[model samples]
Target: MHPTTPRIAIVGGGLGGLTLARVLQVNGIEATLYEADINRHIRLGQGGTLDMHAESGQHALHEAGLDAEFRAAARPEGQDMKLFDKHGTLLSEQATDEDDMDRPEIDRGVLRDILLDSVNPDSIQWGKYLKDASPLTGGQHALHFADGTATTCDLLVGADGAWSHVRPLVTAAEPDHSGVNFVELSITDVDRTHPAIAELVGRGSLYALGDNKGIMTQRNGDGRIRTYVAFRAREDWLTMYGIPFDRPDVARTVILGYFSDWAPELTDLIRYCDDTMLPRPIMQLPVGLTWASKPGVTLIGDAAHLMSPFAGAGANLAMRDAVELAQAVTENPGNLPAAIETYEKALHAYVLPVAEIASHHLDLMISPDGDKQMLALLKQFDAMAAQGSGGDR
Candidate 1:
């Protein structure tokens, strides 16, 4: 390793941070990754499935030389989607062909494993929680960790996620509640134990929305059906509503009470879910968020632009960010400041339009006529795709 080469340190082991490490390694540039988890296996069951878009997630994997592995684990069938109203009336459905690889789905854990395995294991220092980062002279920063240890890096990349400790170093903007909350539930072994629910959800996703609420479900690669019971409510609704989330049975009843008027088939999901539930308040940083580029410091993924997942672009964008940042670093050898400036400029310009679209979709998804609006939006997207294909031909 060249002594003048930047000593890069990435904070976070998420797809973005891991991809950055992998891509940099592929280009013969090494970056140390600091992950809060004890190890890779600890977060195996935390995240749900992710659909890898062709231009972003898949592209990043290709750059990291993991394309073949991703294809082997990818589920093209998971592209299928069924949209319905609260009455169980199916509004729209779309199925992908077996060869449809444009946006194949892969479990989040699986993708993370692939990235984690590709990098040099020794480069990743697991169980290192970043408590703070202070700037030092000569474009360096001192990383203070939770375990009373400190390290210095010539380049600091904050991939630490939404509540990032590194974000304050660049911007004071914080994530705001999007007025929507999700109660996540799961049903394991769905094929044998809950065939009916399996059939209802099809091979991919099920979205039932109305009355400013929704019941969304997705089929995971692990033979589990994960569901998100969404409500357009105050950020504190979970606590103020008096849902005994600690007790699964009582919590199910309390959750179902909110959806009393919905169809029985839809309510069955909440009733049959496992004894675990998580309340997530949807949050997003101000769209078009940008900051002055701090020398030797930058951020990617959720730590950079925390947006609602309604547009399904969060993971894809994060991976793309990693790819671009890696390219900038590799292309501008011995000029860490120039690399940071280039990456930040391109990132700010690229994410603004996508962030606006995500915000718009969030509003449409949680509205009273969300099901109808979503169906129409799907049709519009299909028409645009067809026109683009025809033009290419």
Candidate 2:
């Protein structure tokens, strides 16, 4: 479409989608973002915190011209991380460097709001859940929505996250359970109401592991301690446990039974949780998955490579993909097919290491010798940090 406006449609208003829209807007390329949420307030408690890395998330934010906003909202102290075994003995703790912005933390909702604010309000169409995408002539596709509305776009980008409907267009890989499930719970106003747990968790993340099971907690930006009770079990194990997720009290009691031999301090995580629980089954697509680029369709973020959160690269890679794809389109303008080919090639190479790290970390974190393995890994990281700083500790 030469100098004419290209009808680019981005499905999913996630960080990647929003970042793509903002970066394209910065380059004078207007694109529409179709979000499934009814509105911005659809989920007040969207998710937990995210740490943006310099090479990915922060880089994308800078490209989108939101560096100042991101810096203002990021929490440097949230980088503090502690690890322990089931006995409640602290294995290793990493103190945060107040001056380091390499991986600053931000709440998922806050980051999303920042991205949303930077984009053109008219470009986001909320509540437009994609139903199907039909290929059309001239490298265009028609998007059908659940609300009986349809639109056509010259370029269709899917940043819709795991279980994406758009992934089928490029690859047939489905997300398989990673042999782990997390029962998520939280304690509100933890600093005051649950001082003990707050102190145990510190300002950032804590991992207590043993017996092939684990209890993980991380402090959110809102002073709440979000906890995940993880089990290396079969896909239907939680359902078979017969614990009612709706009744947090009973569920917490029943869940604690599995960890009866664990230290009381560690078990307290589940004991003092608030009256809400969510079952999260970890799933991941085949590692290093790639596909031949289609004429008018592409994907980013979890849609492109769905991996477990162990590597802490999911969000970072998503934003990185957004920046790369946006720049590809900006550079190639009228030649979208070439742009997509270039973007996909770079994307495949970029995501390979991340996927491998995520897979390896998940295996180590949940294996029988997880505690020893994790502690050794932390010591190696400490040694690397010391060496990088020209010091030995």
Candidate 3:
């Protein structure tokens, strides 16, 4: 390791990795980011919406000097949420004002563009699919890529996602199925072509949960309605269910069979989806996963704590981790090991409770009485908010 400036390598070009690189550069430190994507354009229109929490995601952007850009692109009205049951009974609805920025929503692709544009294009090595990473003497690491090329750095940060290749260097923990499966579908030109769905989904998100199953939909900025048909099933159910996923029409019919008794309004989402269907199995690491602090290597975001999307904390936490890690490195100066230890300790402490909450929410939403349980939980939250407001008054 260099005594004054340690060589930093960030693997994975997700929000966390990109934020780290941008923040490091803002602090006058240089780091190389390696992403598997062939180019930045490949991520366009690839991911769904993300709500940037004020204290985490937004704070990270502020640290990286992209606050103005993020604010311009964020949608405060996208905080609107509607909850329903299988019978199309509206259980609860929360609508946000245009100025409500507590957790403003933004398209994932747009957020990535903001971070990408903030960093120097020359610092990013696109198409570098990391094969593996090995430890070298004196707290350094050698990153081997799939293209028969390699690089070494004094500090290695794995911002890679759930199946991070660099995670094994620290902990043996792998993500396990959370018993929830999602069939993702989308409807483009939603407002123009699918007026019924646009009306049903409202502005932001609609969640219809019942019979241990769910149909979740969100309106994207590009006039698309992205939906996830989620249900509790065996990890291998998608493979064995015999649905012709490749044929969108046949797959839609087959999928609708599961929700035959569901309301027409909720089932129409699947009936009018585009030709793409993506099957995703929710996976999670242990609630309080931790590892012995290894020098030159550490993890952030999903690489450290992979949880179901129930809590909606994945991206927020990833950006928060980036901010914390960058601060640790910049504050610790040349002490690379100390910086990693500090960041890991803080990450573990903060992520434990969030992981547990996410696990609990996943269980509640996938149970036989999911709708009833969710309604009760929402009422409890309302009561808590009322009490807090009363006390403040």
Off by over 4 Å in 1: 1-3, 389-393
**Distance (Å) between predicted and true CA of 303, model 2?**
0.6
| Residue-by-residue lDDT tens digits, candidate 1, 1-393 | 224578999999999999999999999999999999988878648578999988889999999999899999999999999998999999999999988998888999889889988999999999999999999987899999998889999999999999999999999999999999999999999999989999999999999998899899999999999999999999999878888889888999999999999999999999899998989899999999999898889999999999988878899999999999999999985888888999999999989988998899888988999999888888888887878852110
lDDT score at residue 344, model 1, on the 0-100 scale: 96
Separately for all candidates shown, the number of backbone clashes (residues 3 or more apart, or on different chains) is 0, 0, 0
Predictions in order: lDDT: 0.91, 0.89, 0.90
- For candidate 2, list the clashing residue pairs, or say none: none
Candidate 2 TM-score versus the reference? 0.97
The runs of at least 3 residues in candidate 3 whose Cα sits more than 4 Å from the true structure, single-residue gaps closed, are 389-393
How does model 2 fare in lDDT? 0.89
**TM-scores for all predictions:** 0.97, 0.97, 0.97
lDDT for each residue of candidate 2 in 242-360, tens digit (9 for 90 to 100): 77887777898899998898889878889988888989988999998989999889999999999988888888889999999999999997888888999999999989888998888
Pairs clashing in candidate 1?
none
